[model samples]
Target: MWPWEHVAVGYIAYSLLSRTVVARRPGVPELFAVLLGSLGPDLIDKPLAWGLGVLPGGYSLGHSVFFAVPLALAAVGVAALAGRGSTGVAFGLSYLLHLPADVYYFVVFGDPPAYGILFWPLVPAAGGSIRGDLLSEALRYFTTFLADVTTPEAVPFLVGEALLLATAAFLLWRDTAARRRGRPEATTR
Candidate 1:
C-alpha cells in the first residue's frame, strides 16, 4: 500500500466507523477533528520526512501510544468538566482509530522509523517491538497486481493512489457538506 492508498482507506474506514463509534454524539466538527487525528500519525510522519530531514519528532513521541494516552486522558478530563460522556467517547474513538492504522502500517510496512503503538502499553516500551511478515507478502501481491496491469514504475502507483485519494476526499467533502446542510446525521461538535 502507498500513502494515497492508506489515506483513502483510512478515510473510508473513518467515515464508516466513526458513525458507529461516535453515534449519538454531538459536534460534527470535533468528529472531523478526531477523524483527522486518526490519520495524524502518518500525516505527521510524511510532512517531516519531506521537509526537515527528520521524523515528525526526534522519535515516536508523537505516534506512540504513550502520547495518545495523555490526549485521551485530556479529552476525558474535558468531557468530565463539560459533563459530556458522549463527546468524550467520540473523541476517544478517533484516537482508537489511530492505533489500528498504525498497527496495520507497522505490521505491513514496518515501524515508522521508531514508533509503534499498535498494542499500546502491551507492546513493551521501545518504538515498536512486535514483528510481522505477512504484511510484506501482501504488499508483494499488491505490487504484483500493479505490475501485471500497468508499467512497473512509480507512475502507476502514483496515479492509482491519486485516484483513490481523490475519491476519498470527494466522499469526505460530500459527508461534510451533508452534515452542514443538516439534512443528515453528522457529528455537530
Candidate 2:
C-alpha cells in the first residue's frame, strides 16, 4: 500500500478505536503520532533500501514485526510512565496496522498475503527492489498505477481509496468544526 493509503487506513482505525475506548476524542498531537506511525516503516526502510542499499529490499528492518512489536511495546511503556499513554497507543496501533494493510492489499490483488515480511531475518527477504532511487521508484509506481487504474481489477481498490479519503475528510471537518465552536468535550490539542 502507498503511504497515503496507510495513513488513511490508520486514521480510520484510530478514529474508530478512540471513539470506542476513550471518553473524549484524540488530540491533534495524538492523531499526528498515529499518522507518523503509519509512515514509520516506509520512512526507515525506504531510505535504507532505496537510498543507501543497506538492505535487500524495501521491506526489511522497520517493516518487520520483530522490530515493530518490541519498539511499539517500548513506546507504550515509556509513554505510560511519562503520562502520555494515549499518544503511544495511537502510534503503536498505526504502526502495527501498516503490516496488515500490506498483507490485505496483497490478498486483494490475488497474491498470497506476505507473512514472511513480518519475520525479517528469520525468514528470507523477498527479491527484486524497484529500479532507481526513491523518487524515481515512486514515480514509476504511480505511473503504473495510473496506467492500470482503469482496468476492472482496479475498481475495488479505487473505490476503497475514495471511501477512505472521503471518510477521513468528513471526520477531520467534523472535528475541526466542533473545535471551532468551542465545544470543550470535542476539543483536541
Candidate 3:
C-alpha cells in the first residue's frame, strides 16, 4: 500500500479504537504518533533497500514482527515512563496495523498473501531491487498505481479507498478544529 493509504487505515483504526475502546478521542500528540507509526516501516526499510542497498527488500526489518513488536513495546515503555501511555499505545497500534494493511493490499490485488514479509530474516522477503533512488522509485510506483486505478476493473476499489481517505481527512480536520476551540474531548493532553 502507499503511504497515504497506510495513514488512512491507521487513522481510521486508531480513531475508532480510541473512541470505542478507550472512550475518548485522540489528542494532537497521539495523532502525530499514529502518523509517524503509520509511515515508520516504509521510512526505515525503503531507504535501506532502495537508497543504500543494505536490506534484501523494502519489506525487511521494519515490517517484520520481530522488530516491530520490540520497537512498539519499547516505545510504549518509554512513553509510559513519561506519563503518556495512550500516546505510546497509539503509536504501537498504528505501527502494527501497517503489516496487515500491506498483506491485505497484496491479497486485494490478487497477489499471494504477503505473510512472508512479516517474518523478515526468518523467512526472507521476495527480494528485488527497485530502480533509482527512493524518490524516483516512489514516483514510478505512484505512476503505476495511478495507471492501475484508472482501469475499469479497479474502479470500485478505487472509489471505496478514496471515500475512506476523504472521511479520514475530514475527521482529522474536525479534530484539529476542535483542538483549536479548546473542546474538552479534543484537549486531552
Candidate 4:
C-alpha cells in the first residue's frame, strides 16, 4: 500500500478503537500523531534503501515487527508515565498497522505475505539492492502502482481503498457536524 493508504488505514483504525475502547473521538493532535506513526517506517527505511544503499530493501529496518513492537511499547510506556496515554495509543496503533497493510498489499498483488521482512537483521530482505537514485525509484514506484490499479486484478484493492477513504471522510464529517452542534464528543482529547 501507499503511504497515504497507510495513513488512512491507521486513522480509521485509531478512530474506531477510540470510539469503542474509550468512547471518545481523538483530537487533531492525536490524528497527526497517528499519521506520523503510519509513515514512520517508510520515512526511515525508504531513504536508507533507495538513497543511501545502507539496507537491502525498503522493507528492512523500521518495517520489522521485531523493531516496531518494542519501540511502540516503549513509546506507550513512556507516554503512560508522562500522562499522555492517548498519544501513545495513536502512535502504537498506527505503527503496528503498517505491517498488516504491507502484507495485505502483497496478498492483493497475488503474492504471499513477505513475513520475513518483519524480522530485519534476524531475517533477510527478499529483494536485491535497489536500482537507480531515489527520484527515479519513486517515479517508477508510483507509475507501476498507477498502472496496477487500472487492472481488473486490482478491483478488490480499489474497493478496499474506496472504503478506507469513505470511512475517513465519514469520520471527518461526523466530527464537523458534532462540533457545529456543540456536542462534547467533538472535543474529546
Candidate 5:
C-alpha cells in the first residue's frame, strides 16, 4: 500500500475504534501519532533495504512481528509513564495494522498473502533485493503504481481505495471542525 493508503486505513480504523469504544474522536496529537505509526515500518525498513542495503528486503526488521511487537510495547510503556497512554495505543495499533494491510494488499491483487514478510529473518521475503537509492526507487515505484492504477483492471480497486480515503477525510474534517467549535467531548487525548 502507498503511504496515503496506509494513513487512510489507519485513520479509518482508529476513528471508528475511538468513536465506538471511547465515544470520542482522536485529538490532533493522537492523529499525528497514528500517522507516524502508519508510516513507521516503511520509514525504517525501506531506508535500510533500498537506501543502504542493510537488509535483505524492504520488509525486514521493522515489518517483522518480533521487532514491531517489542517496539510497540516499549513505546506504550514509555508513553504510559508520561501519562499519554491513548497516544501510545493509537501509535501501536496503527503500526501493527500496517503488517496485515500489506498482506491484504497482496491478496487483493490476486497474489497469495505474503505473510512471510511479517516473520522477516525467520522466513525471508521471496525474491526482494536492493533496488537503488530511496528517492529514485520510490519515484520508480510511484510511476509504476500510477500506470497500474490507470489500467481498466484496476478500476474496482481504485474505486474502493477512493471511497476509503474519502471516508477518512470526511471523518477527520468532522472531528477537526468539532474541536474548533470547542466541543470538549469531540476530542480524545
Candidate 6:
C-alpha cells in the first residue's frame, strides 16, 4: 500500500481505538500525530534525492530499522508530551503499526530473489520499484478481496477513514459552535 493509504488506514485505526480504548480522552490530533510520525523516516528520502543531491534510492541508513524505529518512537513521544497520555499512546500504536507494512514493502518485495539473505535476511527481500507489478497485484488482490466478501471488504477501511474524517469535521463544527456560544471544547461536553 502507498504511504497515503497506510496513513488513511492508520488514522481510522487511531480514531476507533481512541474512541473505544481512550474513550475520547485524546483528541483527533493525537491520533493523527502517530500517522504523521511514522511517515517521517521515509519522507526524508524523497527530499534528499530532490533537494540535497543524494542518490535516488538504496539500502541507506534511513531504511535501517535502527534509524526508523527510534525516530518514529521519538515522533510519538513528542506527540504524547504535547497532546497528553491518551494521545501519545495512540500515536505510539499507530507509529508501530507502520513497521510491518514497511518491512513487507522495503525488505521483502524490494529485493531480488536470486540474492540469499540480504539486508533484511528474515524478510522475503523486497525488490521492484514502488509502483511495480507486485504492488499493483497486492493492491488489486487486497482491495478486490476486501470489496467482496458477503458485503464488502473495503467497507471497513472506507468507513474507518470516513469516521476519522467525520470526527475532524465534528471538531470543526464544535469549535464554530463554541465560538458562537463563547466557550471552547465546551465544558458541557
Clashing pairs in 2: none
Model 6: runs farther than 4 Å from truth? 55-59, 80-83, 105-189
TM-score of each: 0.48, 0.89, 0.91, 0.89, 0.93, 0.47
What residue pairs are clashing in model 3?
none
In the range 84-110, model 2's lDDT, one tens digit per residue, is: 888888899899999888766777667
Candidate 2 stretches with Cα past 4 Å from truth are 127-132, 184-189
Candidate 4: tens digits of C-alpha lDDT, residues 1-189: 788789888888888887788787777767788988999888878888888888888888889988899988987888889988888889988999998888667877778987887888888874445755777777788998899999988898889889988988788677556666776353454
Instruction: Evaluate residue 37 in candidate 4 and report its C-alpha lDDT on the 0 to 100 scale.
Output: 90
In candidate 1, what are the lDDT values of residues 52-99, reduced to their tens digit? Answer: 435322124445666776776787678868886545554565655565
**By TM-score, highest first, what's the ranking?**
5, 3, 2, 4, 1, 6
Model 1 TM-score, all chains together: 0.48
Query: How far is each candidate from the true structure, as Cα RMSD in Å?
Result: 9.0, 2.6, 2.5, 2.5, 2.2, 8.3
lDDT against the true structure, each candidate: 0.53, 0.79, 0.85, 0.81, 0.85, 0.50
For model 4, where is the 10-residue window of minimal lDDT?
180-189
Per-residue lDDT tens digits for candidate 3, residues 26-60, read 89899999999999999889888877878888899
State the lDDT of candidate 5 residue by residue for 43-123, as single tens digits: 988888888888887888888999999988988888889998878878988999898998778876778988888997899
TM-score between candidate 5 and the true structure: 0.93
Clashes of 4: 0
Q: Alpha carbon lDDT of residue 183, candidate 1? A: 42
Give the CA lDDT, 0 to 100, for residue 28 in model 6. Answer: 48
